[model samples]
Target: MTSVKDFRVEEEPTATDLGRGRFVFSDRYSVFDWGEMPDHIPNKGASLCLMGAYNFELLDVNHVPTHYVGVVEDGEVKDLGECESPPTEMAIELTQVPDLPHEDGEYDYGAYHEVAGENYLIPLEIVFRNTVPVGSSLRKRGEPADYGLDTEEWPEEAVDLPEPVVEFSTKYEEQDRYLDRDEADDIAGVVDLDQLEELALAVNHILTDHAARAGFAHEDGKIECLYHDGTVKVADVVGTFDENRFSYDGQQVSKEVVRQYYKRVQPEWVDAVAAAKQEAIETGEPNWREQCEIEPKHLPDEIVDALSDLYCAGTNAYVDYDWFDAPSIEDAVAAARDLN
Candidate 1:
């Protein structure tokens, strides 16, 4: 099981073949790579599943290759429209995810690729940004000029990019870190890094336009892909609030809301997590959590309810479907702001 979802492999993929599986998304949420949180946001699982299915279908219409098969409802895989109610399970084509060999305080991707062969989940995440929002890592990684902003420093608010910026980060590392193009290309093995970037940009364009139509700003998102038969197909979920950052009327309408809430309410735990990560880097320790003494506190019930409404409302707005009887996105965001 992943941090927020339980996965079942009906057929396991071989080194050169595809398999079958389903992801049962739970109401569980995670922040700061802390595995699972103490509370579950009501309806969050169904919201993400429906939103992911919607985006996958939209991508299919745009001729984007993906591992999505359909949503699972009543023990059967069905198209999003065919599902009578909101779904929590998603059927997907499986790709081999061989354990990345780690030794001497370094990950051996060459060994991983040799075992992964042609059919595998790419060990890199492709991120695309349409806007450099406050607290964005891009601000620390690049200069304003690097992103085409004609300013000496980054603005206090979000800045729209002249063009979508694509980036790569390690997926299987103890602590995911950004990688340069050359390193990313080397890690990608036989998969073309340029093609991956192109695919990520296409996804960003599609999601950005979709969010605009729905009156939301899609700031950024990342996607993982599976390489099979010399083809790259987007794997896992896409365009969901959990996977992307969205804002409505200058307010966060995505999981960032919850993360920010934690930052405000549990600052010590957040700081400890960061410090532990740095300590791990210096100490060559793989498990950073072991070094952190602080543990996260549970979110207030009111905050959880507001976030639940936000997820459902955002999904309803993005997909143009009323899957949940929740408040409007505006109302949801307002409620979240009040709680925070």
Candidate 2:
């Protein structure tokens, strides 16, 4: 096994050598490097593992190339004796993208670039939005920063243009940047003008189609692509609320689930979040999580339960498993748009 620094072993689902491959994932989730904050969105790790595998299978069905090897079959899962949890519901095999070296001992983006070669982590983000949901950074900013709708942080009153706004996200900076077309193409070199639009269109179309069938509207979404062996196929989960914006019955229902929990279960943190946002403005680039001196925030039982339920609901809604009568893709999109 390659011994890498900071490569803490997770016992829950150990990644045995199994020849040239392994099944591994992190318990870590970062919104802004608020590292290991003692908050666990119960089932979040499993949901991601399961949902990511599910999407990988779907993409395979769609003839999209991906990095998934296969999930652990019924007999492959084992307990590491650390704790008792459901038998992982499901386990998956994933291609190991070696951790990159960080500039400040951070995750090394450059190493990621080098190791990935031409099939590098395209330092580009494909963002799609369906509606201006409440509590959205855009909504919360209250017009001060426009999300580059017309220009970088355009005025609050700027009406959205004719097209779903597109921006180039920088891969290097401490903060991701939203750049204009020229900046995206000429400067970024991550993608060309026509190609970016085409890629974005394909991603949005597929996710919207999927979301629509689940009785939701496919407002917008994003894709992160790598060149990978000379072809571009979907590289990440396509339609999850974490990756895209979606609504239920004309209501903003995605991240709101988690946000509401914070608001209700940890109302005190709301002021902290707001203050962090303000600090972010002054710093030009903000990492609110780092500013939290109140380390390892506790998640209440109610909050955990709410988040778990939300994850389950979101996953079910996205998959349309007949667990619920989600509409077909077309019907969902139409219904979602009817809200406007």
Candidate 3:
């Protein structure tokens, strides 16, 4: 079924006793809290599928357990082969998603965690940041000085952190909110906070090392974990463009490109969306659009084409294969930067 991201989960026939499903990635893209936007970035799905499977394999090599099984190739589940223009479906072990009910727009996460017990999602998105980029929530939420930087304020450009910073944010909520360690620990229930943090760091290191080898700066990323059998394993897709922020030559090369495009081209709409979200928080109502009376406009065709090229070229570069006949990653990133 459809979820926040532009993907559908289908039950695989081989999943008889095994709780397995296929994540059929789509070309559709989403930014901010908006669901599928009007524009579709071509080859985006293939890029994510390939990159995700690549990272999953890397994690496996590092002896990290994950829900990833393999990619569906030639109508069968098999190892992810050479990079393809458009990757095939991906298989993952399924886990229980317990109901997290809300009362009057306020989530009862404690009760939800109680019901979740073990063998479920940890209910927190562990975010690991290596750099604070422009428009990063960290810039707005805290000061650079607070992060041990000499500057009292953050610069307009991205600034690398003195050390990697790991934070927790609520997942599966209407509006995901960043949480302090104690709050996160309580919500995560049986999962040990320190162990979870270690896993996030390890996963970040894995992705960061690979990104460096691929000539991209792995600025930040988030991962979800599955707590099963008294152990926590990396769950869900990891290290894709959508899940992580990557930069090339000081320019964002990930989905941040789309977010920046919207901020520049549709400032009014973006501001309206932010205002709506704030109003929702203040009023405790879920329908922010009704309160704000604003709708996000679709990206122009040229922007969509640029994004498609970026995804394809970036994928090719990261996978080190001629997956698509597109411009080089540098050229695509330059084009995107020109838009900004």
Candidate 4:
């Protein structure tokens, strides 16, 4: 399947028409919709595989359906035997992909809905939030009070919510836009809006509990689902540092660490990107990247190293295993904090 991360898929001709393939994870990471940046974080692929498998196993035991079959090491399909860390590849069941065409700057979701009969990836991202963090998109697009916070303005620091909030956003579009329940229902023709919310919240419950046990705060996360044979299954990697926002004692222990570093180092480019997005919303045009003439500079070596350590260290702590020889999570967090 195509993804921002380097998760490759290769079909086996010998297998039945029911698709079977290997998901090859890589050290590559993406940020700000920029796919496959120039650097590779050491052991990042292994860390993600380990964490994704961990969550998949948990969901399976809890009776949540998923596409995960097994992990692949040395070309052998095996159980996630000992969760020290995973190899580069994992086996999974593949599904049909919807054809979403765009012509003359307009997306033809109607055609996609018509073609996507019953088994395909859902064209919506169900996002759930437990807190209003410093760089939350909610702060930019909505008022603090919209989420039941008592303040007229969001604080500079993060603010915790009394309860979790669930929302939907367009997934396959060039520029993802927030959607109301009705809008989400219209795009996701096959799946009911209520059922979508139910599955998303169920996942949130499991992950939030897991994060609590790991001593990390699960601030928020998004999960993707697949509609297969009249059933919706959680289809993608979940509960990784990249997929979810986790914090250790108020310091970010997830990819937000990298995002914070970039915002500090590339303030002008970040501001330009934000302006371009706002302009796109105001003008109802989806080609905002063309208007944004700024190119992001490669992250400095020091920042990259710091982020690499953050990923490895955080993964170790979350999985309760020293899979990599890295600094303690506290030390890594301190180093990332010192970057400013």
Candidate 5:
């Protein structure tokens, strides 16, 4: 099970084939690599499932390959448009996720690829960025001119990029770290690095166009893929708020709202989490969470309510469907902004 979803394998895949499974999305959320937080956002699971299904269908229409099959309702798999209500479980084609071996403070990708033949999940996350927001890691890794900004320094607020930037990062590591093209290609195993980047850029463009039509800014997001039979297909959920950062009228319309809320109300815990990760890297301990002393506090009721509305409203707007009786996106963003 993942931090926010329960994975159930109904049919196992052969060495050369795919399997069938279902992802039961949950209301649980995670931040700072913490497994699970103390509060549950109402209808969050359904919202994610709906948005994910919608985007998968959109990708299929655009000729992008994915692992999505359908959404589950009443023990039957059906198309998202056929679902009478929002579904919490998504039916998917399963790909092998081999255990990434970490030893002596180093990950052994050679060992990982030895067992993960073809038909396995790629061990890298392809991230695409159209804008660099405040507190973005890009600010630390690059200068403003690097992303085509005219100024010598990054602006205090979010700034649009002249073109989308695609990056790669470790997916199965204890702590994710950005990778250069050489390292990324090595980790990709059988998938061609250039093809992977092309796929990611396609996804980014599609998501950006959809978000634009929905009146939201698709700032950045990451996608994981499965390599099988000399082909790479998008795996796991995509285009959801959890996987992407989006904004409406300069206000967050994604999980960033909740992340910022924690930063505001639980700075100590957040700092402790960061410290623990750094300590883990220095000490070569794999489980950095154990070193974290402070735990996340439960979110306030008002904040939870606001986040629920924000997620639901944003989903409705993006999909152009009233799946939930949610308030207008403007009202939801206003409510969440007021909490800050």
Candidate 6:
């Protein structure tokens, strides 16, 4: 029966920064311009905090210098006398790196490169994917010959890639612009290119292995690195359903739950969402006309149970070969009849 008390605080945990360095991330959820919608995903905050702490500990064990100290459990407040466990969600000690400048809500890397320089949180989100789904950029590339690069044959079907594909994105970029190795290097100047590549590979392997253990293939994951000084460690939550696509026995879930929801059920308004997003890109105005549409339609009680069970199953399924955590995609369709 664990619960967090303080839900929103922009900065570190204590009034005075503990030399040890403690920071607590916000549990606030947002999509597009919409923040804090009508519905709440039960236990999502707890799970996210727990997952982040778990990865930090894992990286610490592997000698990675991340901004992680420990979990701020159910009762811990600013420490006075040392008790066994503290209150609230996980709060970890992290280096106080200065955040970069942004004007008109745009990342000004020119300023970032000056002040943050080496200490700047690498202004990028790196993604690695292992499968080509329906609307993937690769799928959009289509099967036309000599359209662009002389890429190898790409199957129309959702095919598992032979190797994981890595792409870099500017931090929090909604339309995720792809970056070449040279482009990535140009942005993260202090970042060692060879090391970055190796790190990405290592992260993929680690996540893939553990996700396999968790009954989800690591199909792909992302990591953000901030170079304080010497060491490079994985930042953000690693190998979580939220961070990566998790399929239960080939059933689509993860962000696809939201993605497909936008694409399928409300195709009319959802298309508007996409079109609005595209307009933002073309005009440099992020004015998504549709924000809180219909208060985020809720799932049936049975579907909620199914989703919980899916997560519970993923929690256990990766332990073995049987992908028991998720209902077969066909079976799930039958259950949808219970919903509106």
Model 4, position 132, has a per-residue lDDT of 87
**Candidate 5 overall Cα lDDT vs. reference?**
0.92
**Segments in model 2 whose C-alpha atoms lie over 4 Å from true places:** 1-35, 74-117, 135-163, 186-190, 250-253, 263-290, 322-340
Best first by lDDT, ranked: 5, 1, 3, 4, 6, 2
Evaluate all candidate structures by whole-model CA lDDT and list the values in order. Answer: 0.92, 0.49, 0.82, 0.80, 0.92, 0.54
The runs of at least 3 residues in candidate 4 whose Cα sits more than 4 Å from the true structure, single-residue gaps closed, are: 1-4, 10-18, 82-85, 140-145, 278-291
156-275 per-residue lDDT for model 3 (tens digits): 887899888999999977678999889998888888999989999999998899899999999999999987777788888899888998878877788888888788888888888888
- Clashes by residue pair, model 1: none
Instruction: Give me the displacement of residue 47 in model 5, in angstroms.
Output: 0.2
Worst 10 residues of 4 by lDDT: 9-18
Error of 3 at 146 (Å): 3.2
Give per-residue CA lDDT, model 6, range 69-130, as digits (tens): 46654444332113242122545433334555545746555655666544446777778777
lDDT value for candidate 4? Answer: 0.80
Quote the positional error of residue 278 for candidate 4 in Å.
4.3
Each prediction's RMSD over C-alphas, in Å, is: 0.9, 8.5, 2.7, 2.8, 0.8, 6.3
TM-scores for every predicted model = 0.98, 0.62, 0.92, 0.90, 0.98, 0.73
Q: For candidate 1, write residues 42-112 as lDDT tens digits.
A: 99999999999999999999999999999998899999999899999999999998888888889999999
Query: Which regions of candidate 6 fall more than 4 Å away from where they truly are?
Result: 1-35, 75-88, 95-107, 141-153, 172-175, 287-301, 316-340
Runs with alpha carbons beyond 4 Å of true place in candidate 5:
none
lDDT of 1: 0.92
**Poorly placed runs, candidate 1 (over 4 Å):** none
Residue 105 lDDT, candidate 6, scale 0-100: 40
Q: What are the per-residue Cα lDDT tens digits for candidate 4 across 210-293?
A: 888988899999988877767888887888888898988778877777667678888887788889878977776777878888
**Total clashes in model 3, counting residue pairs 3 or more apart in sequence or in different chains:** 0
For TM-score, candidate 2 versus 3, the one ahead is 3
lDDT of 2 at 250: 55
Residues 74-156, candidate 5: write the lDDT tens digits.
99999999999999999999988788888888899998888889889999999999998889998999899878889997888
In model 3, the Cα lDDT at residue 234 comes to 89
- Model 4 lDDT at residue 222: 90
